[model samples]
Target: MTYTVNCSILLTELPLLERPAAAKAAGFDAVEFWWPFTASVPADAELTRFEQAITDAGVQLTGLNFNAGDMPGGDRGLVSWMGRSSEFKDNIDVVAGIGGRLGCRSFNALYGNRQDGQTPEAQDELAVQNLAAAAEGVARIGGTVLLEPVSGAPRYPLLTAEDAVRVISRVKEQTGAANIKLLADFYHLSVNGDDVAAVIEKHAKDFGHIQIADNPGRGAPGTGELPLGEWIARSRQLGYEGHIGLEYKAPAETAFAWAIRQRIAQ
Candidate 1:
């Protein structure tokens, strides 16, 4: 499997439109991002410029997230939230359009945090429904819908590969769409105390994409204790031929350099 930079986390030094070029300059041929625009349905001009920027940079957009509310703040996702269902529906076609334009085949749909009055059962019911809808929409364009296990406060529901795969199974059963797949993010699994190697061995076939970040610090590969490069190599050995997204926090200009150097050393 090849590597792709997560532009949202890696190149904050440049404007959103310019990050793809920055990734290209760093020797990456592909990039991914969370929903870059605050609006679910951004103006066409904004979309055009984003497309142009990637086209000019000659970097492929390998993955993207649908609008997940405020990412920098505490909001993890919007798709499964009760009140935000309409907002997520509004984002579906728009996200599909962008992904279709860029030839991006995978999209991450974050399962939002648990609400106070909302029972886990209700949230789960809604998540399956929303994921089914998302799957149907993206399927029209031959794209796969991704569900990731995000690590954070205790309120977040999906914290392990098992958690995410359960949800993926529900959505697939609900829609009968084979396009629903798991996003096995090793950092979150490590943070949540799951055996990452066990997850890879068991769920490699379920994975549509994979992301990595070192544990303890969530920094570049060489800066932490996790055997990230080994896991990455292991993923490939396990038959996961998707992008290994560089979704860690590290200083710009040096992050990819360090990761590449560490891979070489390994």
Candidate 2:
């Protein structure tokens, strides 16, 4: 049997359970999503149910993203509503619970707006504290945090790799947990003043997960300006053995399937 490289199928605006089966049919061994609390997802189910679905569907959820507070991509941050602590806790716990159930290897954090009247240092401290708390819960279930940096998003106000590296160092320092790490999204990094493969090499140690999409237009592999084949070759050469998430939106699964096979053939 030919061993296939593991890649994650991004599940956005799709039925949750169907995502895995669809991904499996598309020739992918794993799947991913920005958030899974929607009605279509498995947020209400217990941990066992989540586990059973993935096992039965033959899909592995490499990572799950936390609520990207105050952005089009997410639920507002924990502190967005100060007086409603329970709501915030519920949201976070729901995410953590799913991570635990699915054996999620990493968690993605979308840095949203800093709290009101807070200095940069204070906001940094706040993020570290929150991550540490979440990490503690995730540790029991064998999962880590993978913070993301995006361009043109409120969650990514800084929008640069240097900034992301700074956040990673602080997150690790605060959590002091081995599992808390980073997700390197090529499309965002390429827009945020980082060379695609060069940044991958520079901070590969901090990267616990990776994702990709074509620039100018978020599309299939062959439609982008990135030298994806070269990127994939170097990633393998550098000893990276984690999921390569295809977060782009394709018009149909046909292109996605073709892209995966193309990468594998290369």
Candidate 3:
């Protein structure tokens, strides 16, 4: 049960390029992030700099997200959005390429919110097509594709562990791509009223990655009532040997103290 910081949320006080060093300074040797740029296909120089930043900081890039459109502006995902399918398709290789370069072996593709005019069936069909391709792209780099059940955005379809696992199953069936796996984010599942323990008990082996944040506030572990440490121990008991991503909100100054406490406790 190792831990990695989610730089996208933890260290906003620093520039994006500096977060890895900051995480390392805070006693983390590994980190993960959402798409760091607004564009899916950022310039090669930009990509190189991002990779260099991580290298210079000496922290492992453990996981990354496929470009989900406009994360700061509330666009939950782009691939499943009707007209943006092509954009999403084009970015699959870009994300995988970066992952390969960084040795990051896990990628999460968010299932976007339901559009007003599109039927759920249609959106789901498009997701299967895109995720299948995403799975293949990451597989080429010896990586795995992850499906996360994100909560807080009410319109996003995938809200529970079961919901994400359902999609993962479908993508595997449709694409014959066995690299697809679930990203079990405890905060989201608890926020959506799912039994977190039950989810871990049932699908721990099925999980490709595990992210954690306290519910109700989406903050550090002690900020809420969820038994964060207990759940993590349960995950270990169930045989999940992957990194536990610290995907919680905290100011840069205090980001890793709680995390370090948890790590020491483990």
Cα lDDT of model 3 by residue, 157-207, tens digit? 888888888888888888787898889999988988899999999999778
C-alpha RMSD in Å of predicted model 2 compared with the true structure: 4.0
Q: How much does each candidate deviate from the true structure in C-alpha RMSD? A: 1.5, 4.0, 1.3
The per-candidate count of clashes, in order, stands at 0, 1, 0
Instruction: Identify the runs in model 2 with alpha carbons over 4 angstroms from their true place.
Output: 1-14, 38-53, 69-89, 114-119, 260-266
lDDT of 1 by residue, 1-266 (tens): 37899989988888888889888888789999998898989999989998899999999999999898887788888867998998998899998999889899899999999999998899999998888888888998899999999887567899999888888887777768678889988899999999999998898866899998887889887778998878878878878888889999987857787756755877
Positional deviation of 43 in candidate 1, in angstroms?
0.9
What TM-score goes with each of the models? 0.96, 0.80, 0.96
Instruction: Rank by TM-score, highest first.
Output: 3, 1, 2
How displaced is residue 262 in candidate 3, in Å?
Answer: 4.5
**Of candidates 2 and 1, the better by TM-score:** 1
Q: Of 2 and 3, which scores higher on lDDT?
A: 3
Model 3 misplaced regions, further than 4 Å: 262-266
Model 3 per-residue lDDT at 121: 95
User: Residue 189's C-alpha lDDT in candidate 1?
Assistant: 94
Which lDDT tens digits does candidate 2 get at residues 42-157? Answer: 44454456556677888777767665443444444443233333444455666777766666757676655545565766566666666666666667777776776777655435
Worst 10 residues of 2 by lDDT: 1-10
